[model samples]
Target: MSKLKNIFVFFGPPGSGKGTLAWLCVKRLGFVQLSTGSLFRRHINEQTDIGKQIDFTIRSGKLVEDSVVSKIVTEWLENAAHEHSSIILDGYPRTKNQAETLSQFLSEKFSSVKVCIVRLQISDEKLVERLGKRVVCAEKSCQKVYSLIENSSHKPKQTGTCDICVGKLIQRKDDAPEAVKKRLAVYHSHENELIDFYGENGVTIEDFNAADLVERIFEKFLCRFGFSIR
Candidate 1:
């Protein structure tokens, strides 16, 4: 039998540091990071068929169907399997049904795929503050992220240039306060049920406050995965 692989699912409210932490983990552990949001954004920017479909759904204020999302995720997993690498899934399996589907799919594909679900707990006020200051690069290949409020950590050198790619940074339409609030509502409505599904499946669910230092949170996650940070 093939060795078991690690699969991490990051759960959090909008503006929670899930994306940041996922990137950090991927960089440190060589985990393939899969984020539905990033996938959709990339597709939409490329104007692919799937991108058009997602665009229509978003513009119409309708949720993207689970079938489409599942297909995308499954395809990615299949590709990752060929490489014999683990993955970190971000902003996926938003509902209980999706979580169940993923669990079954992974069970069949791998001898033993241990899943770890991490939830970043943060207050609504802090979330609002975080989202309001977030910015992203406009270039297709340069989607660098930055925060205006948290100038202490990192800031773009220029008004538009991305610190990573030197591409122009722009605010996404969905990042507006009104849109953020709606997204938050949708997130909270389904989060509890999703959490329960993972918990019931014996998946380790760790909750950490967003205020905790990034290094501290990373250390905890590494420890959970039997890895020690140097």
Candidate 2:
């Protein structure tokens, strides 16, 4: 209930269910979820000025310049601060430099931003299987996700459109085996260093099994962050 805003960074390898849990936390805790991947994709799909720039950046296999990424995120944060007390950032700060920039930005914006880092821990084998079978909606507003292998409980309806936005579901270009391996290589190169940076900054890093039951994951999140359902 503190007026001080909270910022949570969800950390995990691909197929760790970080997005799923992040969405749950956002709904239950009223936190705005900011995802770098989703943001970039949104822009690209919209073909906005910024999105066009990002498309070029991605095609070259180069990181989006920090200035561009920071500008977009800062604008969103400034707007959210006026209406919400906290925000959840997923799939961001993949590098130490980005993490440092975010830390400085928050320190300047809020009196004391409570930063929490949650690392979803799952076996590599499991992650590979899960991500390989994952399906993502192509639509921006209706980016409903489905797992063809592990998500037996939530089956995709016969309709090719997402239930939420009627957007067509499609396999991401990077979801293929070779692409996934390349991404994993890139992630491993910097993820540990980024994790260390946050830990050194006093960000709480909690490990949880993302492959567990939904209720169990929810309980773990609440227990670690000391939030309760209304």
Candidate 3:
């Protein structure tokens, strides 16, 4: 088995099952998730320095400056080193500049620079529907996600609490109908350029159904790491 650490980068729109898939992957496999969206929310919600710095940018329906996003992600990854050997990255590297920054950082951090970059391709209609009713765990460590509009498999036992942790579940700001529209529009604008940037860096990219079952999605995601979900 390869001992080198692996970073799985997942690209998807707000409600394209990216978070649910990340949660599923972490549950089934040993990998931890490093979600930019989660980080941003924590920052903004807490009104921390970095969160305050990027709050306006996010609320304006624009991408946060690459420097701010990159710095936050780098700090998170650096701190996560001792806790997890594998990481599933979601919501970072939305732009080519961020991709370049990540490429350089990953090259230095891991023995092999090759990464499994997965893109969950979904339609705009589906994304809106999914985010409109998406439920997220309030607990930081427990990111169990469910979409009431879709994915019957991940519905929690309680009305508004996580099935596992019993944490309160809330809809993400970006998951609101209006926010979904803005985020999706931004996604479409930058998706292709990011793909091209990744291709130029020579990382392997995989495309999957954005609407697949959580278990099935992670099954394929784990395959890239030579892992299987039980």
Candidate 4:
């Protein structure tokens, strides 16, 4: 089996640029990016056993059990372990229980893998401001995110259109100013608890200012891992 190197767990609230940083790592370093949301969708589309469980839970208006989510993730890691060295985990292990579960699984199965819990920090006010200006391509297959902020690197070349797919750009309902505030409130509630748990467990933790531009944030992430831009 190929030796896995690093597992980067990106912990951040919404609008903190976790996706952008993960995308950059994948593009630049050829690291495998694993997102729980994407995995859920892929499993459901393929009608896997775990997918059926997730679908049932969602349709019944209940969150999937932490054990179920962890199972699917570990299964994916087992399959991907032989091929990928560096892995970027985005939007998983949201709670302390989930984090503990993942930690145990990694220690037992992938003992040699280095885990880095990267905390992407930004003020809730700034998050609200940033998300409020966010827009995405309306095309289902080309849901590229963009921002209306003048200095954002993700601004579309043409107003109201996606630069890549030429699809109409629309603001997500969840990105509304009021909605963003609600989301941030929920995130802040348990943010410290999660941080404390990771620290207590002796996991390698790093903090980065996520309010910076995407390029700058990517550069910092690379520097943290001793990677240089190719």
| Candidate maximizing lDDT | 4
List the global CA lDDT of all models.
Answer: 0.79, 0.78, 0.79, 0.87
TM-score of 1: 0.73
Comparison by lDDT, 1 against 4, better one: 4
Q: What lDDT is reached at residue 132 by model 1?
A: 76
- Superposition error at 90 for model 2 (Å): 0.9
The alpha-carbon lDDT assigned to residue 36 of candidate 1 equals 82
- Score every model by TM-score: 0.73, 0.75, 0.68, 0.87
Model 1, stretches more than 4 Å misplaced? 1-4, 37-62, 134-151, 155-178
Q: How many backbone overlaps does candidate 3 show?
A: 0
**What is the C-alpha lDDT profile of model 2 across 137-173, one tens digit per residue?**
8998677786676337655774455766777878787
Question: Per-residue CA lDDT of candidate 3, range 150-222, in tens?
Answer: 3476677778889888899999887888888887788888888988887887778889987776667777766
Cα deviation of 175 in candidate 4 (Å)? Answer: 1.6
Please give the ranking of all candidate structures by lDDT, highest first, separated by commas: 4, 3, 1, 2
Write down the TM-score for model 2. Answer: 0.75
Query: What's the lDDT for residue 24 in model 1?
Result: 82
Give the per-residue lDDT of model 1 (tens digit) for 41-160.
888999989889999999999989887788778877877766645688877887777888898888888747778788899887777767777789998977877877645375777766
Ranking of all predicted structures according to TM-score, beginning with the best and ending with the worst = 4, 2, 1, 3
